[model samples]
Target: MARRTGLPAVEVLDACESTNDEALRRARAGAPHGAAVAAVRQTLGRGRRGHVWVSPPGGLYLSVVLRPGVARECLRAVPVAAGLGALDACRALGAKAPRLKWPNDIVVLGPDGVRKLGGILVELCLGQRSAGAAGDAAVCGIGVNLTRPRGDGIRPKAVRDGMPAPLPAAYLDECGAPAAAGDYAAAATLFRDAIVRRVDAWAAGLWKDASAAPLAPVLEEYRSSLLGLGGTVLAVTPEGTVVGQGTFLSVDGTGRAVLALAGGGTLSLAPEQASLRPLAR
Candidate 1:
């Protein structure tokens, strides 16, 4: 663990079950905001909707504990702001044109196809107090494959359009990004600073009762950098059920995925409601 000015504390572990889990434990014990945890490898890394995240060595795995002073409704925008921060870190690490997959994924277009570069998982946890109380926090976990793992290669499984699809992972090193573990720790610091700025901007808007006005700038930049916008997509639940299929529109102010349905209606899905998959036109 190392302490840097303005960063508070960043605990880098040689190995852990999950950085998110570790950070959540610290948050429950009253760790202040901006506290972060990172690991060289995770034996039990997981993502949204109970999906497993293969956290081999040479990957950037980090989680930051956040305690933003905002109402419950305003929490929905946290992931949106965090995603932008992750995107900023990716670009800083030299990943060219990384597109944010709706909800919490960072991917890039390659000759093989659109492969994943990294992903984010935001989990809300109770603080030292009970639910709906003053003490509550969220863990924003970020995982980026910095270099190719030594093995048969990472072909992680995912659900796409009501079926299980195997994803061939993409590494940042493939795009000329830095791969040293020390660089990864620096990236984690970058992510923390980036997310804090965005969250503060959003909280200011909400405090003034300016509905969507504060998020306007964040949403604008997010939508433009989003992948597969204006293309066909399917929103599927974790149970492999197709909830909706439509043209992918912009992610709205509150971070809902706005889809233009095939039957002349629009559908808005929260991050937990579904995982989006692109479809061929």
Candidate 2:
């Protein structure tokens, strides 16, 4: 049996289209905060910008419903908090120096290079507003590759322009977490606990005085473990347009990517606005 955390309810399924989809459906139906849905495999798994997430049976797919009636500015930090939570879980499970890729990706550095271990997606479902509060429910979805799929099994399919090419997928098993494999329920529970724990703290801080500044500690923690700080990178929009190319700096108070442009200007992009990619020197 999996140990319970702050979650109110947990549903484990053999397979689902996507845990985020199911969790959103429940949230709309008035499911209370802290409800979680996890599946062994996802048929229609998706990442940010509707990119397909290859969800094999060996991975952990989970989504948690959060109803933190804070303002939009505070809500923007959800991904940052969730990313830190995922990083903590990875570290707790013995993966060394797993760093957060801005906005959503959790990656591990290896001898060859950086390889992705998992990713997060946060989707908001707005609720009726009353009494000067922002009524919103966010489903924080996370996916971690615990073991390499068989042939195309656990290996992640990399994005290719016009040809078929796949990169070697990073696995928790290979990163000193062999214990996470062969146990879907336990792994999902651990992920939910770790992620929700940070979100809980973030929400509490925002609710206290209705200010985002108090949550600066969370932002700094994220900044410390952020991958590619000081590296040249491109902020690409979902349409594949280059929004900005600059040196990576720390994220701002509201969790926006701050960059130092070459032309003596700065750019700050929201998580929903663009995806960051490394610019090869």
Number of the top candidate by TM-score?
2
Candidate 1 residue pairs in backbone clash: none
Off by over 4 Å in 2: 1-6, 131-135, 153-168, 213-217, 279-281
Worst 10 residues of 1 by lDDT: 154-163
Model 1 C-alpha lDDT versus the unseen true structure = 0.76
TM-score of model 2 vs. true structure = 0.89
RMSD per candidate (Å) reads 2.9, 2.9
Model 2: per-residue Cα lDDT over 135-175, one tens digit each: 68889999889987776764345642111232346889889
| TM-score to native of every candidate shown | 0.88, 0.89
In candidate 1, how many Å is residue 170 off?
1.3
